[model samples]
Target: MNGAQSLIKTLANCGVDMCFANPGTSEMHFVAALDSVPEMRAVLCLFEGVVTGAADGYGRVAGKPAATLLHLGPGLANGLANLHNARRANTPIVNIVGDHATYHLQYDALLTSDIVGFARPVSAWICESKSAQTVAGDAARAVQAARSAPGGVATLILPADTAWNEAERPAQMLRDIGPAPVSSQAVDDIARLLGNGKKTTFLLRGSALHGAGLEAAGRVQAKTGARLLCDTFAPHSEVGAGRVPVERIPYFAEQIVDFLKGIEQIVLVGAKPPVSFFAYPGKPSWCAPQDCQFSHLAHPHEDAAGALAALADALNAPAQSSIRVPLQLGGLPKGPLNAMSAGQIIAELTPDDAIFAEEAATSGMPLLVTLSTARPHTHLPLTGGSIGQGLPLAVGAALAAPERKVICPHGDGGAAYTMQALWSMAREELDITVVIYANRSYAILNIELQRVGATGAGAKALSMLDLHNPEMNWVKIAEGLGVEASRATTCEEFASQYAAAMQQKGPRLIEVMI
Candidate 1:
């Protein structure tokens, strides 16, 4: 068997059956091997970012690693932004990055660059396969690294010669490595805090934000009267009307401080202590009150679900009554076709089971608040704080959960970054409803300029923020990308277009002229 064949077998044995790829010449052997392997499905992507982002979505839903096939350093570089998001989410991903043959390194070809340097920032574990005999074993190690604990990105760089060379035998498949136990001392401290009876919050994150861990948090909250909050930035949050309703900590520092003001203790479960996004003038980095005692009940790498279950059992916390209620959307203003404001459109456009991919920047804060009371849905925010991820994430999500309607309520500035994803949506006939908040400028940058105390900006400095010497023609762009497109100037048109897009089978775009 060839090294590439054995590597593919290793990946399949480790449960990574899906591969999202954007290949190059160096990866031809791997690609050929993938074609020969019947069980593995390789999804092609025009951009590396889409491949990585799709892998993130698959891992979040599939609860295992999805392999990514990227070219050399430049290809890996292209995918790094989404890898950042995946790492932040703790989504398991095995990356197979192709490299120059061992003998070709001294020649310093055009594609030759610091692939390992590029990978180290985003990957939790990285390895370079030296020979064909070791390539399959290296791939197996990559899968294990990705599957470790709460999950993370693992990269295996394979030289062209290594992939093409012959392997004597296939690598041994590895067994499941269970999560590390929560610290006994940490659990004891949390027990003491609960016994004290002061207002405490057990903030959830990582896998603890889903399924049984959520239920355990609900039970604990019901018994102790402590509020339950999710992490400020989560990889994937499993929230709905019927599930234990978890309030996420606000992104704004002052808002988080206000939220945590009365709480004397904060116990973490697969979450870190809340902190400010940036250190503003005279503001603290950490959001908790002066006397708030911080403790970790379980680390991110621990078995968060098991730990929470154990805590619930030890305390004998009763199942929450609120956990089994039907979903309800509160009364929202409608009917008048006034200014097609963000608030009005949000209330009118939201559906019962929509998956919201929001990278709406500043204009959507009001939308976020309003939609919190809207029907139950999976809300995916830009977790890594990167601007361009929303569009690609929306595409991947729509493809992954095809049965559920997907909504890409995107900020125009951020949407432009991965606007190419619209083409993929069109090609795949994904059920995606994209609403572009075309405010004609980088609205968030204006806010940042003010925050950093930069004042008296001239027309030239201000001009850089504007997207309109000629305003962006999003409808034109969408149509060019092979998706059905429309423009909306009024609330009625916005609502009509949004509803129409939701009902359609293929990808559709509505450019809301805000």
Candidate 2:
């Protein structure tokens, strides 16, 4: 067997079944070996960013790692933005980056560059397979690293010669490593703080913001009267009816400070101290008040659910119970569709168990408030603050949970970054409904321009933030990419098209003109 075949076998044996790839000539052997290994599913993407971003989505839903195949240094560089997002999300991903043949590196080939240098900033672990005999072992180790506590990004550089060379056998499958145990001392300390009369808030993220961890936090709040708030951008959160309701920290620093006005102590569970996404002219970077005390109950790598449950047990909290949100479908506006109307439409139409991937910069915030009382669903936000992850993430979520419907609401400017994901969704016949908020401008940048104290008196500075010089035709773009799409000018038109799209199968797009 060749090294590529052995590596594929090793990955499959280690429970990695999916690979998102955008390969070039250097990765031909690995590409050719895909036919030999029927267990590893190969998904082709047009851009490296989509390849990486899709893996991030799959990892968040699948609770494991998905491998990504990139061509070379330049190819790896193209995918770095999404990899940055993956790292911030703490999603497990194995990046298989192809490199030049071992012998060809001495000649200083045109495509040769520092692959490791580009990978270190985003990767938690990186290794290069020097020979055919070591490639399979390296692949196993890469999966092990990716599946470690809190999960991480692991990069494996494969030379062409090593991939094509003969290998004697595949490596042994590596067993999964569970998250680290929560510290009992930390749990006891948090319980003491709660027992005191001080007003405290629980800041949550990662696993603590969803599933059983959320229930534990709810119990603490029910018994102690403490508040619960999640990070501004969570990798994956359980939301909607019947789940514990947790508000997200506001994106703006001033709003966040106001939100935590009365809180005297903060107990962090798998969450970091709140910080502004960017510094403003006069505002402080830290969101909490200057006098607020901070306490760490559990780190990201620790078992957050267990830690919270222990704290609840110490406080004699009540048993878990259903928490319901009354569905309130606001009156739909009759005129042109704005953010409020768009949010209301989504709140009324979203199905139970749906997956919502959001990147609708400033316009999508209203949906967050509206959908809080909607049907039970999973909400995956842009964890790394990257612009182009929304569509690609929806593609991966649909692939991971085929039985559930997936919805993507994206800004017109951000959608342009990874619109290639729509083509993949069409090719795979994925069940995803994409809603484009076509405001014909980078609305977030306009907000930032004023926040950053930019004196924009000239037309040129304003033009840089506007997209109206030639407005994007999303319907045609979706049709060209093999997905059926329509344009909606008013709330009624948007509601009609959205209802029809949700009822149908496969990929569809609705461009909301606002």
Candidate 3:
């Protein structure tokens, strides 16, 4: 067998059956190996960013790792932004980065660069296979590393010679590893804190924001009068009617500080202590008050849901919380095409079990609030501050769970960063509905400039954030990419387009001119 074939086969044995790829000359052998390993389905993406982001989305929803085949150092660099998002989200992804042959390195090839340096920031585990004999085993190890504990990016740098050379068989599937066991002592301590009668809040992330963990948190909150709040941007969480609701920390530092002002204590469940996204003049980076006592019930690498459930059981908490959010479908507003009306339309019409991969930026906060009372669905947000992850994330979510609908509600400026994802959706025939809230500017940056005290900025400075000189015709863009598209200039038009797109299957785009 060739090294590339064995590597693909090993990945398949490890349950990473899907590969999102944007390859080059160095990766030809690995690309060809796809035909040999039928168990691995290879999906081509036009941009490396899409390849990485799609894998991120797939991992968040499928609860496993997806492989990404990137060209060389530059290709890895192209995908690094989304890799940053995946790292923050703790999403599992096995990256196979192709490199020039071993002997070719000394030649100082034009494409040559420090691949390891580019990978270090994002990868939890990284290796460069020296020989064909070891490539398959290395690939297996990459998969294992990607899925271990809290899950993360694992990179295997494969040289072209190693990929083309003869090799032994594929590696056997490694032993499966789950999240580390939650500490019993820690659980008991948190239970006592909950019963201490002090005002406390639970800061949550990871699995604790969804499914069983979420339910346990609700039960704990009902039994004890504490509150449940997730970070401003969570990796994955089940929200809306019938589920235990979780309030998200506000994006602005002042808002989060004000939000956490009165809480006397905080217990973490698979989450970090609240911190501001950025430092502001005369503003604190730490969101929580310094006097508040803090404790960890579960670390990100531990079994958060299990720990919370045990805490609830220890407190003899009720099976269900009385604070479950009730269904509140809104009557669509007919006047203006704006964030509030558009948000209500999308929220009220969102189907159960749907997946919303969102990077709506300045236009998303109201939508997030409205979505809390909509149908039960999984929500994936930009965990890393990166803006371009939304469109490609929906691609992976749809592929991982094709039976469920995947919606990408994106910002016009950020959406431009990875617009090629639309082509992948059309090519893969993924069931996704993309809503483009085209306000024709990087509106968030405008707010940021003012917040940062950049007063009296020139027209040239403001022009950098504007997108209006040449307005993006999203309808034509989507059509050119092989997806059906439509435009909505009014609230009524938006309601009709969004509703219709939701009812259909395959890839569809709706541009909301706000």
Candidate 4:
């Protein structure tokens, strides 16, 4: 068998069956080998960005790694932005990048570039296969690295010669390394800190933001009265009714400082310390209070759920979660269809077990408060402070959990970056409802411009932030891409269209004209 055939078999054996691909000549052999392995499902994406972003979504929702196939250096480079997002989210991904034949590298071909340098920043582990005999083993190791601690991108560079050459049997799955346990002594130390009279807050991420970990945190909070908070843009969080409330830290530094002012100690569990996304003039980068102490009971790669559970046990916590968000609904808006009204309509209509992939920019902020009390669902936000991830992210989430409906609330500006995802959604006939918030501008950048102290902005400076000389018609775009769509200008119109979309199942788009 050829190396590509063996590699595909090994990947499937390693429990990675989904592959999002945008390949070229160097990867033709691998593409051809897909038919040989019936287990590995290869999904075609029009753009490399969508390939990587879809992998990120699948990984987050699937609780495992998903493979991505790219052409070469330029192709890997094309997908790097979403890879950056995947890296920051700590999502597991087996990124397979094809390169020129080993013997032809000396000729300085047109596509020959430093693939290693291009992939290094985003990959937790990277390697290039030297020959067909070793390619299967390389694939096994790549899967192991991707599934390792907190999870991350593992890039395996398969040379063209390595894929086309003859190879032997597929390698067996490697033993997955699980998160380290939080020592009993460490748990005692944190338990004591929590028992103290000082005001404390739990900064949670990763596994701590959902499931058993979240339950344990709630019990501890009920016993100790500690506050719970998560990062501003959480990778994946369980929100809405029946889940413990995890308030997100505010986006701006000043807002974060105000949000966390009274906290005396911060206990981290698979989370980073509070810090600003970017440096601003005269704003503190570190938003935590001066006297606040910090302790890490569990690192991002450690057993956060176990740590929280142990801490709860040590504190003699209650048997059940202290308080949960009760199922509730608010009145719908009637006149104008703005961000607030849109959020209300979405929250009111969202069914239980739905998934929301949001990159709604300025338009999504108003929805957060209301969504907290909506039907239970998973919320996946942009973790890398990058735009253009929401649409493709929904594509992967829907594919990963086909039984659940996926709703994407995306800004017009961000949606343009990877709108090709819509075609893939239609092609796959995924159950995704995309709501494009077309405000005719990069609304977030306009706010940032003033925050950064860029004063005296003229028409030219302001023009750079605007999206309106020609407004994009999302309905036409969606229709052209094979997905049925509609446009909504008033609150009554949006409420009707969105409610109808939520009740049905195929790929659909609703342009929320602001």
Most TM-score-accurate candidate: 4
**lDDT tens per residue, model 1, 106-176:** 89999999999999999999999999999988988899889988789999999999989998766666765
Which residue runs of candidate 4 sit more than 4 Å off their true CA positions? Answer: none
- On residues 285-367, what C-alpha lDDT tens digit does candidate 2 reach at each position? 99898899999888888888889899889888998734445666675567779987998898888789999988888877898
Question: Model 4 scores what on Cα lDDT?
Answer: 0.94
In model 1, the Cα lDDT at residue 179 comes to: 80
In candidate 3, list every pair of residues with a backbone clash: none
Q: What does the lDDT read for residue 148 in candidate 1?
A: 87
Candidate 2 deviant stretches above 4 angstroms: 321-324
Over the stretch 434-511, how does candidate 4's per-residue lDDT look in tens digits?
999999999999999999999999999999999988879999999999999999999999999999998898999999
Quote each prediction's TM-score: 0.93, 0.98, 0.99, 0.99
Superposed on all Cα atoms, the candidates' RMSDs to the truth, in angstroms, are: 2.4, 1.1, 1.0, 0.7
Inter-residue clash pairs, candidate 2 = none
Error of 4 at 138 (Å): 0.3
Model 4: clashing residue pairs?
none
The all-Cα superposition gives candidate 1 an RMSD in Å to the true structure of 2.4
Better of 1 and 2 by TM-score: 2
- Better-scoring candidate (lDDT), 1 or 2: 2
Reference-based lDDT, each prediction? 0.81, 0.90, 0.92, 0.94
